[model samples]
Target: MKSYKGRGVVLHTLKYGDSSLVAYLLTDVGGRRSYMVQGVRSRSGRGSKLALFQPMFPVEFEGLESSKQQMHRFREVRAAFPLQGLPFDVRKSTMALFMAEVLYRLVRESEPNEPLFDFVWGCVGALDAMQEGVANFHLWFLAHLSRFLGFCPGNDYVPGAWFDIREGLYTPVQPAHTGVMSRECSAILRDLMACDVRLLSDIGLNRSQRVEFLNAMLVYFGYHLDAISAVQSVRILREVF
Candidate 1:
């Protein structure tokens, strides 16, 4: 067994027996791994709260990685920091709910990617710090995530152009394929592609605009990744928005 120390974000979890859980985590050092966390329900099992394993929660852990087994065992763990605004704030909470599902489905690799890990950690922290204009953050995140997922959409959108989601580029005419963003939505896409993440709040989007853009991204991501069959939190995100 190899001893490991790393930071990670919880992506999903499943309850096991009565006092334990099976958690899927995206780690900075180990990439993706699942652990059977014990004593979470009982007060006697190391005092580690089950909330530490909730979706999108950032944590630091010490664990054992064994070559013979796929599921690793965590010896100890703690929250990376208090994400003050995410849990209590409804809009951010819904966004986090939607995003955690997306990442759980999209980020499947089990190899160390420090850059990807940093981006995930940073964005979660950003959401916690942000106080306004959260309406566009999810779309912004999806657009930027394409860079790491190997299909960064081109920013060459023109007045009459449609964005071919599968092509990840713009064209004067829509493609024969079903994957395309409308002219107005395409313009929004270009702006999002060009704008920095920190300045996403500066861009104004009404509720319809937000939903359309988010749906476009969902379709785009679904076209590219086979694992993302559906995003269940999308409707909830929209309803809460």
Candidate 2:
């Protein structure tokens, strides 16, 4: 088997039997793939390796690729960069869970997408380094991620205009569909779409407003992608932020 080196963002992992793990990661070289890592769950020294597979953790790995196998094997795995804050901070950690779950559910491609990989990798670093806009970070992430997912919202906002979630644009005339966002929520969404990730601190939302906007954005996402309507971490995220 040919060994390949790659960087990836850990999306999810599950225990395999009692002493191993099956990890799903979105890689720079192979897009999304599952790796069957042996003995990571053991009570001895290998248990520490489990930390490397946490949600949204970025890692560099050497793996053996086999055309015949659905689940690949990792020769070695280690963190790509040390995260200063994400794992220790409760709020950021919760947001990481939400981000990871959303990515796992929506990104199913096996082929590599360099632009998307770079965007996600950069965002993971951004999230770790971020300090001021912690509350709005996930919303910022989702807004930017939509560009990669092919349904980035239109930023043309006018007074009294509603956002047509189904159409992915701002409309002066109210959309008859239930997927339309009210003027207030539309204005917020417009701001979210227009703001850069570095400027997330400038956009402020109260808890209710944040929840409402997140629900609206998820609805917008759900309209375009199947099975994204129910992200399990969303409820926990709402309570945390």
- Candidate 2's C-alpha runs over 4 A off are none
Candidate lDDT (C-alpha), each: 0.85, 0.89
Model 1 misplaced regions, further than 4 Å: 43-48
Give per-candidate clash totals. Answer: 0, 0
Error of 1 at 10 (Å): 0.6
* Tens-digit per-residue lDDT, 132-203, candidate 2: 888998988888789999987665688889989888888999988799988888888778778878888898
lDDT per residue as tens, model 1, 95-155 = 8888889888888899998888888999899988887768888888888888888898665
Return the TM-score for each candidate structure. Answer: 0.93, 0.95
Superposition TM-score, candidate 2 onto the true structure: 0.95
Clashing residue pairs, backbone N/CA/C < 3 A, model 2: none
